[model samples]
Target: MVLYTLAPGIRLSFNEIYTSSWEKGDSSIFGERMLIVNFCIHGRCDVSLAKNRYAIVKENQVCISTVMPTKDFYYPRSLYEGIQLYLDLDILHDENGQDFLSALGISLEQIVEIFCEKDGLYLHQMNDTLRTLVKDAWDGKDDIEIGTLRYLAVRLLHEIMSMPAESETETYFTRSQIAMVKEAETLILSDLTTRITAKELADRFGVSESSFKFYVKGILGDSYLNYFRKKRMEKAAELLETTNLKVIEIASAVGYENQGKFAKVFADTYGVSPLEFRRLSK
Candidate 1:
């Protein structure tokens, strides 16, 4: 964790990696009455909210919140890598000990109001511009000068303040729905030899196939068949590189009944045949 205090009440921190379920909030030093901007590069975030509810922040998305979590932030996958910018409005002040935010006018606040949920979180898909800025910062965060950090922080805010509200309605999943999707992952992925159609899986879960696909896309970031195929190909590649199995045997092990089809798909996925991949691994 690298934290840069850009100004009196504004700061940015780089969360490189956290392999834990929960992160105890330590922002007490920054005080309450805060606004947070989270840019997720990978992993998922579960922000504790009022009324025993939690808001999710998926990879490649931004989460803005006006209220700080009362206890800890939860990472459902036990992983989180991202950047968070904190603005403690209560402690924000100028050199003259005045409210410096007044200088920002109402544009910033308007943006916040438009996105912030009531004791929840407002999540947005980050644009390419913001993604590049955040990615560059995350890549060279330690080397950035203080002045440059300040500029980046302000520029990020400015970029966000300029975005118009989204016209498409955002969707929120219940905890039960999320749990159901995770169970589907285990059911299908644990044994790749059998193909499970999305309709079959959804029927087992008692959800519409369309809704099931939506949940999968939102939580896992991939459609059902593609995700399964990707895992199968990855497993096949691993076997080719590590084991002494023949190409046909490796193909069967990864649920491919036809060696010719397997080779074609493997070549498409990795641009190499199984035997060629093995040679390259050596």
Candidate 2:
């Protein structure tokens, strides 16, 4: 387990877990009253709350739980890997934070209801935007500093409370199906030079074309082509900022055959052309 204390009210933990079969532990939530968001980046685990009551947090899923200072929660761990955040919601009452939350359509009472009241453990598959944001939070990428993390935690609360009802796709998907989707993602990110089609990926993974597309859409919150292009564009930007590669070389590296088209997309994504980005970075 790796931990980061970004502030007094916010702490982040990234756990690379390998426990004995059926290992058990007492979660310190019994003594802490805070909002917790756990992202199961890989693997899964079951959390036992009260007698004969439990919640299973699946892989690639996220959960929000509110802890009571006097309640005991048991974790009968299987192999678990995840990133978790501890957020002291009381911090929001300071200054104009509550007002800021209200502007975002969230109120302290609502937050309390979602995080402090009821059974209080909620789980859902993250939409692509939130998925990426959580990953950035773990990777310490993009400007996810202490202040940004606080903002993200608040935004996360908004998302959790506002998410729509579960669809059939979310309600049921086998581990094999999840693995197929992850394999497809691996293939997409494997080679930036090659143009990979959804059909080709489906065929490679032995899944039907439509089902593969649907699964990718459900997990990534975008069409496969759109997501792939976004990743490629991000790669192009990295090359521009870190290397002395020419525009044509960068474009080619990102699977763009036409430099002009690449320039247009890059400008749209970064508000400047590739050369300008490079110059600014330097």
Candidate 3:
């Protein structure tokens, strides 16, 4: 993957590969505060963010609005590749921000609330103009790339924030509920290597252990430990495929103390020994 900072508060990143499938890899935790918008330009890949997993992103499709400290993977990968744009919300405090939001018919108050709530993993229906802008970003247009991406980003955000609350009434997870989950997810990811117990997580959210587990299971369909392991394993897999790091080294990096246990878990999840997986991947 190659990352380019297109402007002061915006960036473009992408990777192109020709392969039957992507070897299982580790999830990436975003440390900086920014909103990420990803466009799958060429092929398909599964992206797991927060507690939710996106299985297939095809050409011209987009995944928008994820906060930092999230996990993701690309799956059943066939020459899978795409571009990601990161935008700093602070930029919206200025005239450009106002103009952009105004054009999308979103109010300043709504934007503030959305940011305060820290929403995650929002997918928007794409229109022709939005689709074309994403293509332009991937094509590396020098003259208008940054402006186009920023414009599209704001437009998409407005569309999401402006939708009638009633329209989402049937959704199992409300906007507030989604925001809370994302907040919990962010806390969990902030320190992936640390030992975080259920009690601690519940305390942080001011909820009972049962409630926390229920929320996690209800939205993510898994317990907290299972979700964390998936994220760690996903990150470990990415390192194995992209680097020449030793197995022991990779194990330690992903928070494993016993190499034997790490290898066992990795093999079970991936259906191959770590060494074998690495060799075949290359």
How far residue 105's Cα lies from its native spot in candidate 1, in Å, is 7.6
Candidate 3 or 1, higher lDDT: 1
Question: With candidate 1 superimposed using the best TM-score fit, by how many Å does residue 6's alpha carbon deviate from the native?
Answer: 4.0
Query: 1 or 3, which is superior by TM-score?
Result: 1
TM values, all candidates:
0.74, 0.49, 0.40
Q: Residue 91 deviation, candidate 3, in Å?
A: 36
lDDT of 3: 0.59
lDDT ranking, high to low: 1, 2, 3
Displacement of the residue 178 alpha carbon in candidate 3, Å: 2.0
lDDT digits (tens) for residues 154-224 of candidate 3: 66555445433221211244444445555776665666566677778788778788877776655554587
Worst 10 residues of 3 by lDDT: 162-171
Question: Which candidate number has the best TM-score?
Answer: 1
- Which scores higher on lDDT, 2 or 3? 2
lDDT (CA) for every model shown?
0.74, 0.65, 0.59
Query: How do the candidates rank by TM-score, highest first?
Result: 1, 2, 3
